[model samples]
Target: MGVTIRPQVGALPVRFDEDGILQVLLITSRRSRKWIIPKGNPMKRLAPHHAAAREAFEEAGAIGEIEGRSRGHYRHRKRKARRQFRCRVAVYVMTVERRVERFPERGERAVRWFTVDDARGAIRNRRLRELIARVAADLASSGRPAAGQPA
Candidate 1:
């Protein structure tokens, strides 16, 4: 049988420092060790945005208020022991409000903050790269972050 395609949720976590410089967070995948945003398949009884937030927390020690609506989506491969599945991820914009020193999966992943230019380079997915570009342009024009408002 072909690998079943399923929808997942992701959080594009961002934080603005005192200087108003916007930065996006990226974390290394547990298995592939690739740089990507926090994401996972949806959990039962949780809203999509909530699931995205949970993934962010568990994967990167991120705590934030996520927009109820998704900004966009991207597809990636979910690698298993000997197979892979394509997952369509609905992504939400999370304005980072807190950072914990230790979280549920702290030791399993490496997290970093990067500028839009760096993010474009870090993320390989074309759709995700375009999403970052749109977010950057929206933020640059409005002087506000992309908080899931059609960015």
Candidate 2:
């Protein structure tokens, strides 16, 4: 049997305004420097969705109401110290309520909001790309804005 890869929970933070315009938030992976949603390994005692929210807060200073059900999940190879880890990341859809100027890992990563299409392109993993595409399609139907749709 192959090695067992643990599952990690993450947040796909979205900014949905009154008009249902959707926006997605992406942060640079501290290790790979690739565009990705806020995510991390499951916390010690927190629930998956709750942990995902914490990641958003620490990574992007995002405070929001996170959905309990995961919108989707994808598999990716995460690079650690000197090895690659095969991990599955379950993503919750977080509706951002407010954004703070400071975060714990503020300097560790560069956070950016992007249109779902742009986010899809920025992602290196095929599964992640498809996930974002699916998410965008679902949200756009509601007249939701793009993740990084400018004001």
Error of 2 at 108 (Å): 0.8
**TM value for model 2:** 0.87
Among all windows of ten consecutive residues in candidate 1, which has the lowest summed lDDT?
142-151
lDDT of 2: 0.82
Encode model 2's per-residue lDDT on 40-144: one tens digit a residue: 899889989899999999999999778777878999887777887889999887878788998899999999887677788888989888987887787678665
Candidate models: Cα lDDT each: 0.86, 0.82
Which digits, one per residue and each the tens of the lDDT, describe model 1 over residues 35-149? 8999998999999999999999999998878888887898988878788889999988888888888889888999999987898898888999898787667666777665555
Candidate 2 deviant stretches above 4 angstroms: 17-21, 143-151
Backbone clashes in candidate 2 total 10
